[model samples]
Target chain A: MSEDEIEAAAGASVDPDARHAEKMRKKKAVRDKILATKTVEKGLIIVHTGKGKGKSTAAFGMVFRSLGYGLPVAVIQFVKGAWETGERFALERFGDLVSINAMGEGFTWETQDRQRDIAAARRAFETAKDLIRAGEHHLVLLDELNIVLRYDYLPLQEVLNFLTTEKPPHVHVVITGRNAPDGLIEIADLVTEMEMIKHPFRSGVKAQKGIEF
Target chain B: MSEDEIEAAAGASVDPDARHAEKMRKKKAVRDKILATKTVEKGLIIVHTGKGKGKSTAAFGMVFRSLGYGLPVAVIQFVKGAWETGERFALERFGDLVSINAMGEGFTWETQDRQRDIAAARRAFETAKDLIRAGEHHLVLLDELNIVLRYDYLPLQEVLNFLTTEKPPHVHVVITGRNAPDGLIEIADLVTEMEMIKHPFRSGVKAQKGIEF
Candidate 1:
C-alpha cells in the first residue's frame, strides 16, 4: 500500500487511544481468568531441537535468563569441543553460579572415531547426571546432547530415566541439539523445534563470532 | 542399556585418541576448504517467528551476544509495554552503547483500541527507521514488530522498504514476533520459525519473571 493509503487506513480507526484502552481492559479480564486458573509451579524439561540453528544459542540465553533470577546453572557441552565461545566468556563472569564444561572433542564428523566420541559423550553424561543429582544447579543445560543421543553414544533410556527419577523437582533441564528423539519429546514439558526457513550459511556465508558462537 | 552395557559399548573402540586425531585432521581439511570458499560479508536481516515461544528471548540473547563483540545495539520494543525487563535492566548497564525504547503501552489485548495501537506502532516504527538510518548501531532488534505488523498497526510495505533500501551494509537487524509476513520472510537472510511442539502454559503454569520476560 502507498504511504497515503496506509495513513488513511490507520486513521480510519476512531479514537485509537480510547479503543485500545477498552480493548486492553477486556483483554486483562480474560488474561486474569486464565492466570487465575494457573497455580502450579515446578521445574521444566525444555528441549530445543530441529534442523534450524539457535537450539544451543537459545539454551544459552536461558542460562543467562536463569542467572538474572540468581539461579545457579550448569552447562555441559557434549560436542562443541574446546573452541573459544563468546557465551563461556560472557557467562563465566558470574563466577560460582555458572559452571561450563565442554566435553566432546567436537562434532561427530569432526571427531570421526566412533569409540572416542562415545567415550567423550559418556563422560559428559556423567557430568550432566552429577549436576542434576547435586541439587545445587537450578538450571542444567545439556548442549548438543541430542547429537550424542542421535549417534547412540548415550542411550535414550538412561537419559529418560535420569530426567524422570533423579533430577530435583525444582531444577529445570534444557537438552539441545538437532533430531531430538521421539521418546525425549514425549517426556519433555516444553519442546521447541526451530524450523530453518532460510540460512545465510547455505548461501556461502561463514558464521560470525558473536552471531553464531 | 544398562551401565555395564553402556560402558562396554563405549569401550569397544581401540586407540580412540589416535583415531579421533586422524578423524579431526580429515574433518578440518574439509572445513578449511569450505571456510576458504566463503569470502563475502554483508548485513543480514534475520527473523524469528512462529507459534512457539523464545522469539523475543532469542532476540534478547542476540543483544547480549552482540555486546560480547563490543558492538553497539538498538532495541526498540513495539508491544511489550513499560514493564521492567531483566534484559532492559541488564543491557542498559552498558550505558550509551545500547538504546532500548519500549514504545507500546502494552499488548494489543491490553491496550484494546486499534487506533491507539496503530499510533503507538507508528511512533515505534519512526524510531526504528531513524536507528537504521543513523548507521550507528551494529545490531538493531525490532522486538514484537511482527505482532504489530500482523495486526496491521504498521504498514508492512514501508517496513520492508526501509529494511531493503536504507539499512546499513554491516548492521544486522533481527525482527522477532509470531506470524511474520511473507514479504518479511522472503527478504530475511535467516528466518527461524520457533515451532511449538509443547508448552508449559498448557500445563497451567504462569509466565515467570526472569524466564519469560
Candidate 2:
C-alpha cells in the first residue's frame, strides 16, 4: 500500500505495529531523498571544542562507534595522559582494532613547565602526524590537541599546515579539547562546540569514575 | 617515598614510566581531595541540548560507557523510533543489559498531527517514568524527550515535576534534544548545550550509516 494510504489507515487503528509500519514507510522516502543528494564521501576532519564537557567524550564515542564498523582507530592523547580514564580502560578489550597512545605529560597548569610542556606537545604532534600519514587507521583521534594549540605549546601554523597538507586523504581525524583554534575550525569538515549551560562541578560535585572519565 | 619526592626525582628522568608514575602520584592527591569532599551519590538529571549533532550520540556513549561498568542501561527514544540506528544495532550484543525502546511515531513534522503527537509523547513519557521508577536500570536515556517538551506535546511542568519528585533518587536520567525547556535546565544536575559550529550536512554530505545514525 502507498505510505500515505497506510498512514491514513493507521490513524483509525489502535495497533502500534500498523502505526509504526506506516511511519517507517513514510520516513523511508524522506531519508532516501536525503541519501540521494549526499553523494560525496571523503575522510572528515572533525573538531569538538568549547567550554562544556563531552567534547572528548563525544570524540571517544565516535571512536567506539567506528570500531563497531570494524574500522582501525588510533587515539593519541595530548593533555589527559597523566590521568587514567574509563574510556582507556573500556577500549582495551577491543584488542588490536584500537591503538591508544597517551602521550601528554598533563594539562598545562598541572605540568607547570612551559619548555617541558612544549617538548611534550611537539612529541605528541609528531606522533599524531605519523598516525595521520600512516593511513593504516581509518580514524585517528587527537584527544585534547586543541588545548596544546590554544596554549601555543605547538605552533598553530605548523599544526594547520600538517592537517591541511600532510593528512592522508582517506584518514578521518578528530581533534578534541576546549578552546579550539580558529584556523582549525575554518578547515574542519565538522565542528561541534559544547557549551556549558550548567555543570555539577560548580555545585561541588566531583567527577565520577564511569560518568566523567 | 612521598609523592613529592618521587615527582622531584622524576623531574630529571627521561623515562616515561617514571614520569607517568610521578604525575599519577600528584594527580592522585588532587583527585583524592575531590573524592573525599563528594559523598553525595544521587541520581543525576543530565540534559544534552542545543543545535549540535552529538546530544544523542554522547548519551549513547554514556550508555556504552555505563555498560562497560556492568550497569543496566535503557534508552527511550522519543522521535527516532521509525529508523534503525547504528547504536541500536551495536548495542544488541549486550543482550538484556541494554534496553532500547524507540516509542515515538516520528518527529512532529513527520507525524503532522497534534493529537497523535501528544498521545505518542504521553505514552513514551509513561514508559520512561516506569523505567525510572522501577530502578532496574542505573541509567535511563530519554532520547529526544526535549523535542516533545519543546512542542508542548507533553506539559513541561508535569515533566519537570516527575523528573524532580517521582524519579528514583539513584537512577541517572539523561534527556537529549534541542530547545530543552528552561525549567528542565534549572532542575538538571548537568546540562550540556551542543553548539553547531559547522556541520557536513550543510556542506551537502549525507549522513553515513555508522557516523550519523
lDDT of 2 by residue, B1-213 (tens): 987678668664546645554665677778667768776667789999998978887887787777777778998988954235556655775678888788888766565565777788899899999999899998899999998888778989999999889998888899999999899999999999999989887778766645665
The ten-residue window of minimal lDDT in model 2 chain A covers A81-90
**TM-scores of the models, in the order given:** 0.86, 0.80
Quick one: best DockQ, which candidate? 1
Candidate 1's C-alpha runs over 4 A off are: A1-28, A81-83, B1-34, B81-84
- For candidate 2, give the docking quality class from DockQ: acceptable
Query: What lDDT is reached at residue B65 by model 2?
Result: 77
What is every candidate's alpha-carbon RMSD to the true fold? 7.1, 8.5
Model 2 sits at an interface RMSD, in angstroms, of 5.4
